[model samples]
Target: MGEFLIDLKVNKNYIWVYFIAFYTLWCIRELWLNLYLDSIDSVPGAVTSAIIKIIIWVIPVILLVIIMEKRNPFSYLGLLYNVKNGLKWIGWASLVLLFYSILNITLLKNSIDFQLELREWLNVVLLVGITEEIVFRGFLLRKLMDSFRFWIANAITALLFVSIHFPIWFYKGQFEFPYIFSSILTVFVLGIIFGFIYKKSKSLWSVIIIHSLYNLLVSLFY
Candidate 1:
C-alpha cells in the first residue's frame, strides 16, 4: 500500500502530505459523524456533515495551494473555469438522469418511493458536490494525475472513495455484503465518470454538477 506512494512527492512532498492529511482527517470526521453525530440521513445531519466536510476537505486543499505557491489554487484545482465547456459536460451527463429515471419508473416504480426536499437538494448540490469534488476530483485527482496516468489515478481515487464510504455505512448498518459490494461498484464507476468529465474539460464545475445530480437522482431511488 505504501510502496505505491513512494514516488508521489512534488512541491516539497506536498501531494503525499496532502493525501495523507486529508484522508486521516476524513477518517476521524467519519468516525465522529458515524458514532456520535449519526443523523446523517436527516436534513440537519446532512447540513452539519457538509459543514464538517468543508472544514475537513478545504483545509488540506488550501494547504496544498499554500505549499505549491506558484499556482493559483482555483487553477491548480481546475475549478470554475470555461463555463461553456462545463455546460457541455453537464449536457453529456444528462443521460444519467434519463437512465436513472427510466429505471425508477420501470423496475423500481412499485418498490421505490420518490420525494424531493429543497433543503436536501441544496445540501447535496451546493455543499456535498462542491466540497467533495474539490477534495477528490479537484485536489486529489489533480495530484494523482501529476504522478500517474488518468485512468490509474482515477481508479485509485475511486477505490479510496468507495473504501471510505464503507466504514461509515457499516457503522450505520448498511452492510448486507451483496448490497455493499454493489454500492461500492456503483461509486467506483461514478468516480471514474466524474474523473473522466474533469479530464475532458479540464474543469471541476461540470464534474461537480454531474456528481450533485447523480446524488440527487440516486436519492430519488431511495
Candidate 2:
C-alpha cells in the first residue's frame, strides 16, 4: 500500500512536470511562429515549425528517458508498429475520416485540390501527425493511464488537447462565441476517437497515419 501510494505520487508528478514543460514550450513555439510566419514564406515557415516541434515535443523526452531512466524510449513512446490488428484498426480509422472527406466533397459540394504545396505536405501531412501523436497519445495519454483507467486518462488528455488549441483559435480570431465552443467540442471528440484508435491498435503509427490523412483531406476539400 505504501509503495502504491509512492507510485501514484510519482505518476502525478510526472504528469505535472510534462504538462508544465510542454505547455511552456508550446506557448513559446506559438509566439515564435506567429512572429516568424508573417515575415517568412511557406517553406521556411514549415521548416522552422518542424524543427521547433522536434525540439519541443520529441527531443526532450528522448533525452530524459535515455539519461534519467536509462530505458529505450521507443516502446515507451509507442514507436513500435509490430502489434496485431495494426492494419485492421488503421483501415477502420481511415474509413471514418474518408467518410467525412467524401461527405464534404459530395454533399457539401466543397471544392477539391489535388495539387498540394510542399509546406502543406511537410507540415500537415507528415510532421503534424508524427509529432502530435508522439506527444499526446504516446507520452501524455500513456502516462496518465498509469494512474487512471483508459477512458479517464484519455478524457484528461483530450481536454488538454483542446486547451492547447485555444492559443491558435484566439490568434486566428475565431475564439469567440459559438464558433469557439463548437470547435473545441469537435477537437475534443477527435482526441477521444484518436485515443480509442491508439488503445485498440496498440500502434502509434496507426493514429499518425489517420491524423495525417484527416488533415490532408481537410486541406484539400474543406
Candidate 3:
C-alpha cells in the first residue's frame, strides 16, 4: 500500500492532496498546542513550543523527502550550501536586514523588549526559520513548481503560508483588525521574497537566514 502510494506520479492532483494532508495535520497540532500550551511569553512555554514545532514540521518533511526523493532529506531541501555560496547568501541577507531595520526604525518603532539570549536565537533560527522554510519554500514550492507555472505556484504558496499563520496569531490575541491585516500582508510579501530566493539560489539556506534575522529584528523593534 505504501509502495503504491509512493509510486504515484507527482502531479497537480497528487500535490494538492499532499498539501491538504500536510496542513491538516499541521493545523491540528498547532491547535492542540495553543489550547493546552502555556503563553509563549513565558520561557518554559516558549521552549516547549519550539520543541513541539520542530517535531511537528520536521518529521513529516522527512517522510516526504524519503518517499518522494529517496535521498538525504537535508540535501533534498537544498541545505548543502558551501562556504562561497553561504557567504553569498549572507550578503543578500544583509541587504534584507538593512531594509528591515530601516523600515522598523523609521515607521513602526515600537519599544518592545528584546530578550536577545542564546536560546531565543537558536529557536528563531532552528525552529522557526529552518523548519518553516523547509516546509513552505523548500518542499511546497518545489512540488508546486513541478505542477504549475512559477508565478502561479508561488502565489498559491504565499497565500497558504499567510493563511497558516492566522490560526496561531488569532489564538495568541494578535487578531486585532489593523495588526492582523498588516501582519498578513507583510507575511505574504515575505513569502514571495523567500520563494524568489529559493528559485534563484536553488537552496533553502538563504531564505532561512533572511527569515531568522527578520524574526529577530521584529522581536527587537516591533
Candidate 4:
C-alpha cells in the first residue's frame, strides 16, 4: 500500500509538470502569433485583419482547452466560460478607465493625435488590445498564479509584460536610458493596477476592457 501510494504521488507530479510545460509552450506560440499578425501590413481590409487576428488568437486557446480536458476529464467548463460575469466587470472598468483617461489628458495636458484611420483603429482595438489581453491576463497571469504566490506571480508577469515592449524602443531608435526607464516604470505601474483588478475579480474580461479603454484614451489624448 505504501509503495502504491508513492507511485500515485509521483504520477500526479509528472502530470502537473506536463501541464505546466504544455501551457508555457502554448503561450510562447501565442506570442509568436501576435508578432506575425502585427507584421502583416499589406492586409487591405479591416475585416480581413480582424478575421486573421481572431484565428491566430482563438486556435491556441482552443488547443489549450482541449489539452486541459484530456488531462482532467471531469473538469468543469463553467470556470473557463464566464463571459457574462466578464462583461459586467468590463462595464464597470470602462467607466473608471474613461474617467482616468479624461483626468490624464486634461490635467496633464497630453496632446491628442488622430492619425490612425478607422480601419487602423479597429485593428488596434482587436489585435493589440483584445488579443494581447487574452494572452497576458487570461493565459500567462492565470497560469503563473497557479504555480506561484499571487504577488510573486504578478511581479514576474508584469516584468515579462514590460520586457516584451523592448522592440518598440529598438524600432523607434530611442533606446536611451531615460526612455527605457520611464517606459518600464509606467508599464510596471499599469501592470500592478491591472494585476490587482485580475486578482480581485478573477475575470480576464474586466482587465481586457480596462486595458482597451486605457489604450484608446491614450491614443486620443496623447
Candidate 5:
C-alpha cells in the first residue's frame, strides 16, 4: 500500500512530512474556523479565511516543489503555461460536465439561481480551485505516478483529497450518513477526473478551471 506512493520521500523523507503537515494544518484551520472564527464575517473574515488557506493549502505545496523537488514552482505545478492545451482540454471537459449539470437540473426541475458573493468568489471559487489542484493533481498525483500506475495513484490521491474535506464536514455537522457518503464519493470521483484531465493536458490550469466551474455551477444551482 505504502509502496504505491511517490518515492521522492523514500530517501529525503520530506515529502510525507510536508503532506502530513499540510493535512494537519488544514484540519486545524477548519477546527479554528468553526470553533472561533465562525462569527468573523464580512471582508475581514473573508480575508482571514483566504489568508489561512494560503498558508496551509498553498504555501506548503509551493515549498514542496521549490525545495523538495528543486524545480520551478510554475513548471513543477504546470501552471500559467500550456494555455492552448489547457483550453482544449477544458473545452471537452466542460461539455461532459455541463451536460451532467444540465441533466441534473432538467430532471430536478431546477434553474440556475446564479448568485455568488465576493468572498465566495475570492476564497471559495478561485482560491480553493487553484490551491487544491496545486496540492493534489500538480504535486501529489504527478509525484505518485513515479511509483504507481495512473489509476492506482489517482485512486489513492482521490481518497486523500476526500480526507482533507472531512474536518470541515465534521465541524459543520455535515458528516452524517447519506449526505456525507454521497459527498465523499462525489469528491473522490472529482479527484479522479481532475487527475485524468491533468494527465491528458499536462496543464494544471485545465483542471483548475473545470474545478472552479464545478464549484460555480453548484453555487448557482444549489
Candidate 6:
C-alpha cells in the first residue's frame, strides 16, 4: 500500500510538472506574440498570429528538451521505420478524419463560422492542428507513456486536452454546456485516435501530418 501511494504521488507530481511547464511556455509565447504584434503596424489575423507564436515558442522548447533530456526532437518522426507501414497508418488515420469532418459538418453547421477566413484556416492548420499535436501527442503523450500504462496515458492526456479548451467558455461568458460537452467529446475521440497512431508508429510526424490534414479538411469542408 505504501509503495502504491508513493507511485501515485510520483505520477501526480509528473503530471503537474508537465502541465505547469507547458502552460508557462504557452503563456510566455502568447505574451511575446501579442507584444510583438502590437509593435507592428500591420498585423495578421488571430490564426496567423497564433501559428507564428507557436513556431517562435516551440523552437526554444525543442532545443531545451534536446539539451536537457538528451532527446532528439525528431526521434518520433520514425524515419527508420518501414515506409509502407507508415503510409498505411497515415491513410487509415486520414480516412477516420474525413469521416469526422463529415460528422462535424452535419452536427455543428454554425460552428464552421468561427473559422472562415484564410488566415483563420491557416491558424487551424498550424496552431490548432500541428502545434497542438506536437504538444499533446509529441510532448505530453510521450512523457506520460514513459511513466504510466498506455491507456492511462491516453485518458489523462485526452482529459487535459479538453480542459485546456475550457478557457473558451470563460472568454465567451456563457456556459453553453451542450456545445462544450460536444467539443470535449470530439477532442477526446481525436486524442484517442492520435494517441493510438503515436503508439503504433512511434512517429510524431505521422500523427502531426494526419492532424494537420484533418484540421485543414474540417476548416475547408465544414
- Backbone clash pairs in model 4 (N, Cα, C under 3 Å; residues 3+ apart or in different chains), count: 0
Instruction: Tally clashes: model 5.
Output: 0
What total of clashing residue pairs does each candidate reach?
A: 0, 0, 0, 0, 0, 0
> Which is superior by TM-score, 1 or 3?
1
lDDT of 2 by residue, 77-104 (tens): 7776645566787788678877887788
lDDT of 3 by residue, 56-139 (tens): 677887887797678788887788855356568769788868886777677876565666654466565456888889889988
Q: Which ten residues in a row have the lowest lDDT in candidate 2?
A: 33-42
Q: Tell me the tens digit of each residue's lDDT in model 1 across 1-222.
A: 575466333453676666677778877877876675546667777777777777887776876676665577887787747779999989878886887788878887734445565446656556678888888888878877876889999998888778767666776788787788888888899889888888998888898888888777667665
The deviation in Å at residue 150 for candidate 3 is 1.4
The candidate with the higher TM-score, 5 or 6, is: 5
Candidate 1 local lDDT, residue 210: 83
Q: Write the per-residue lDDT of candidate 6 for residues 1-222, one digit (tens) a residue.
A: 999899677754654766677666665554554556444223354655665657643665576457545667766433345556667888887788767777877876624545466545555576665677777777777777778899999998888877666554444443386666777788788888888887887766677778888777766663
- Name the better of 3 and 5 by lDDT: 5
Report the C-alpha lDDT of model 5 over 1-222, residue by residue, as the tens digit.
576455534634565677898888888888888877555456788788888888887787887777667899989889967889999999997898789788878998777765677667777778888889989998888888877899999998899999998997898789998888899989999999999889888999999999998888777776
lDDT order of candidates, top first: 5, 2, 3, 1, 6, 4
TM-score of each: 0.82, 0.89, 0.81, 0.67, 0.89, 0.70
Which candidate, 2 or 5, has the higher lDDT?
A: 5
Global lDDT scores for all candidate models: 0.76, 0.81, 0.77, 0.63, 0.84, 0.67
For model 1, give the 10-residue run with minimal summed lDDT: 3-12
